[model samples]
Target: MTETARDIVMGRIRAALAAAPPERVEVPRDYDRQPLQGPADVARFAETVADYQARVLRIGADEIAGTIAALLPVGATVAVPGDIPPDWVAGLATVPDDPPLSNAALDATTAVVTGCAVGIAATGTIVLDGGAAQGRRALTLIPDHHICVVFAGQIVDTVPQGFAALNPLRPLTFVSGPSATSDIELERVEGVHGPRTLDVLIVEP
Candidate 1:
């Protein structure tokens, strides 16, 4: 039988390992398991999210509904996940995902309102696990604009901390900023894979 290049390389690797058995070294993996305490973490998260060019509105819990109404254009049809707070969408034209809107219907809406599962301060990322407030993945992806409500209590300081708080088995969507990418000439283009505009409402802890 003829030996190939891969075989030759493997044989050499085996010979080297046999000649000098490698030592078993224990890798220290003290992952980010520290408890989350205080509101500073939330402030950091808001600052980082703003650097991505997304609008970050830090408001009082009572101001959420009115703030959202003021930010959106009048007469715009807003899409909402089934669990969105009724008071938040009060007096606004809203379509819920009770029967699950078709892709065309989602595309036609002015914006989608959702609440994220987690917010990462380190990367300015928002994670969705299709929670009742988040709806299915399609609801946010098909819409042109996303108005995500993230509570200060949901913000974590690091990715590891964020993962620690999430279920590993759930379907998760990580959004760093409004869907955008540059062309070959480096011209910025938005709404490539998801909403072109992301408006984050960061309520006080």
Candidate 2:
């Protein structure tokens, strides 16, 4: 049988690696973790996230469930974490991922709604440490749509500020808008890596 192009390339890569193994270099981590900038900019976060084609909504805490219900398709079933607030998912059909749903199971759900670990205003990024209302990384990845609720207080102005609030030991997944990729010809495709649509609800007082 003839070797495929993929196998040939992989074999050459393996041989090259065996010939000269790369060295491990120490990464520097002495940067300031304090907030060099002022307070977190909620507006900046919203603007940047919207630039990625994500839908960003600012609403009161009381309107979370209602807003979510209205935004989602009628009769949609949402996947949620086990510890998600009861009020956040009120009046919605939900399947909790406490036992950890299979990929197919998660895909069957219309969307995944969860609370985030933190929000970075500088890069319009949402971080999840699998705590609070956030299930495993799979819960958000497998579903076609993800609705992440970020509290105003959780918004940080910079990466350092975001890091200051998080525990590095926990598993972290940073999402900046919906998953999208461009091919060599610049043909844009959505949901290539994760959710095709990302709806961010910013809860304010």
Candidate 3:
């Protein structure tokens, strides 16, 4: 067929598709359901996180501050995000988050505590960003131990579901476990690029 004839045919097909009734399309099935069983899911999630060499703790809301204090040594500096709950570190020697802390300052810090955006159950990942509870990316990277508090409301059953719950505009950091690396000779090492120890506190609402 000539080029002009092919163009005409294509235009007609496009018009026909546009003119078709919307009701002719099949409805997509619903995939968002309670994919997890009661109690079992939460237990499994904690176990999975621990299996990655990360420490996971389930605690009541009232115990948060005490737990944080215990994780950090006395007089040890801690970096806390601006939006972190004040009560979360009521008695700890926490340093308020300031912009562009020096590497020396960070190295001296014992821990960094921040709130997470979401916790993925299937992969046991914690997502964070430079948002309200989570300070700048530096806060997470520089500390030896990272204490992330994940509210139960923020936990999702699957990764796809977690993505759906996240804001596309915000910067996101996905952490599966503590930072580690292995040498060419197969010797394992920890704290190569990020915190060597990750302490996750899953707080119940």
Candidate 4:
């Protein structure tokens, strides 16, 4: 049988790999994991999120529906995840995510309301693990606005602490602020990749 060019190249590559060392690399994890001094603080989380240009609203459980309704514009259409609490969208026009809306449909929607898996206080990051109230990744990415409801109990003091509370295998989306990027000339642009506005409602007990 004649050896083709593709076969010749692959054979050489396989031979090279076979001759390479079988040793595994050990990574160092001595870096600081939880650098924060005190317990997980909601105030610190709110301040850090605001520093990232995302709006924060601290409210009690009773005010959740009303507060969310107030933030959205009149006649706006919102995308609600399948597992999201009904009370959160009591009076709003919400499209369910059970059927998994198309990207174009999601883009046309005014905003998305979701519940976060865990929140990192130190880095001001909200993680969505595609669990429960948090829908698929595209649901959050395609929308122009995102209104996430985070519970005070879900806040962790540091990144390491946050990781310990979640499943490593799940799809995680860490959002620090509104999607933005600066060009070579330093011109800032928002909504280039994800939502331009991120409004977080930190519901306290």
| Candidate 4 lDDT over residue span 1-205, tens digit each | 4569889999999999899957898999975565445557999999999999999999999999999999989999999898899999998999998899988899999999999999988899999999989999999999999999999988988888888888999999999999999999999999999999999999998
Separately for all candidates shown, the number of backbone clashes (residues 3 or more apart, or on different chains) is 0, 0, 0, 0
lDDT of 3: 0.84
Best by TM-score, which number? 1
Q: In angstroms, give how far residue 109 of model 1 lies from its true place.
A: 0.2
**Candidate 1's residue-wise lDDT over 1-205, tens digit each?**
4579889999999999999999999999988778677553777788888998899999988888888888789899999998898987888899998889999999999999999999999899999999868999999999998999998888889898899889989889999889999999999999999999999999884
Candidates in order: C-alpha RMSD to true structure? 2.6, 6.1, 7.4, 4.9
Please provide, for model 3 over 52-71, each residue's C-alpha lDDT reduced to its tens digit, 9 standing for 90 to 100. Answer: 89999899999999998888
Q: Give the number of colliding residue pairs in candidate 3.
A: 0
- The collision pairs in model 2 are none
lDDT minimum window of 10 residues, candidate 4: 30-39
lDDT of each: 0.90, 0.93, 0.84, 0.92
Badly placed stretches (over 4 Å) of model 2 are 1-32, 36-39
lDDT of 1 at 196: 92
For every model shown, what is its TM-score relative to the native structure? 0.86, 0.83, 0.78, 0.84
Residue-wise C-alpha lDDT for candidate 2, range 32-149, written one tens digit per residue: 6776464578999999889889999999999999999988998999999999999999999999998989999999999999999999988999999999899899999999999999
- TM-score, structure 1 vs. true: 0.86
